[model samples]
Target: MQPLLYNMPTLFAALGIRLKQISRIRQETDDSKPHVVELQQVTAVQVLVKAGQHIRGEPVEDRINSEEVRRLLDEFVPEWEVREERLYRRFETANWRVTLMTANAIGFLSEAAYHHPRLVLNYRSVEVYLTTHDAGGLTKLDFSLARKIEETVGWPRSREEMPGRRPKEWLRS
Candidate 1:
């Protein structure tokens, strides 16, 4: 049997599809954190967020040991809660709770969701966990957010003590 021109075009389309294969997500390295996330053209860095335990992941180690981490935390992150949602504390825009209702962290979690879409957020006694379903583990996004949370809440002691962490600044947030 002979194929028609229309059939010829369809065959070519099929060939194109067959020629392409989806990319896979892979771990990141050399970032000093010792772990990273890169998948299907997406890039993410994994940072460990812990409350107690003193230590675990390499990121935590770096943060404590690295003078850079110390400076960023000391200089950038406000020691007290800010009135806005500018990474210091939860405010009108920076409020994650509200963001959760509206999924404001959508872009934040997009990459994690793309690869392992399944995420389980557990607010434990001391800390919260954000893990990826596809990766079957937690990624840097989780830790980064956790660190943000710590900063947002004024250094992780408690909401009450947050104000004491730093001096009052009307324009802080």
Candidate 2:
């Protein structure tokens, strides 16, 4: 009897398909001079990995162009500056407590988004820099995180708008 076998690993790799599992298939075979087999059932789960595409069908993140970055900065986040292909901002706090508070806020946002940033903390200031390391440059993730940080830790004068007691100096951009 001749048995037909497939080199599944090699086949899957060549086809750019990731195999999850394959259950046993019931096969029908006839005994004769020439062996013949029929596959009754086959089940498979695979992920197709295409070039510049994620396995889960998510689009690959691309670096933003300089012109696009500039336009984004001008239109939405004028307070942010792009340098060395990174989105950057600095906030001067009233004191060490405010500095730590600002850093904690940024850390929380970064952790929640699963995106991290480079933070330089001083006695009375915090400098934030964001770039997507995997993408090798800034992407939407960086901009979105930066915007969240700004909204969470607003400018020093923003505190004046609060109804209750407010510190004269909280954070200055």
Candidate 3:
């Protein structure tokens, strides 16, 4: 019984997936805010270093700690074949929280990085790095990685309740 149950992910979704009705994902009307986008009906951001960023996104620190960033790289296990990257790290803490970002969102990140620090864009086939020493010697690679991961896992899949803390349905149109 235990082994069979463990193999079935839906069983966990029954007990694991706990939250509200998750009505719909709405965008904040106020432009003065930090581009607050909702997740429920849409994919809600799981974790934020500063939760308030939800209300008003803070200026991206533009600093990706080496050790910390490496740790996060562990979770986003990018699949070259699917061109999809999943959150491999736990979002329990900022030190360990993984953020995914992408190219299409460069403008937003450009502003977040103060539009100075050069960013590196890596393609699946060829990894590229564009580092600029002018805008304070620091790497914006974290933002790039975050954006990539975010774009890859867009629109969290719709799911119904199940047993354990397992996700059964990630199907989206």
TM-score of each: 0.23, 0.61, 0.25
Give candidate 1 misplaced runs (Cα > 4 Å): 1-39, 44-70, 79-88, 94-98, 101-173
Q: 60-93 in candidate 1: lDDT tens per residue?
A: 2111323443454455443422222122223222
Question: Local distance difference test, per candidate?
Answer: 0.30, 0.62, 0.29
Sorted by lDDT, highest first, which candidate order results? 2, 1, 3
Q: Candidates ranked by TM-score, best first?
A: 2, 3, 1
Tens-digit lDDT track of model 2 for 48-78 = 1111232233654688888888887887678
Best by TM-score: 2
Residue range 44-91, candidate 3, lDDT tens digits: 123222221212334434444556545545554332111112112111
lDDT of 3: 0.29
Model 2 bad stretches (over 4 Å): 1-60, 158-169
Clashes of each: 5, 0, 27
User: Which stretches in model 3 have alpha-carbon errors above 4 Å?
Assistant: 1-66, 77-104, 113-145, 148-173
- Between candidates 2 and 3, the lDDT winner: 2
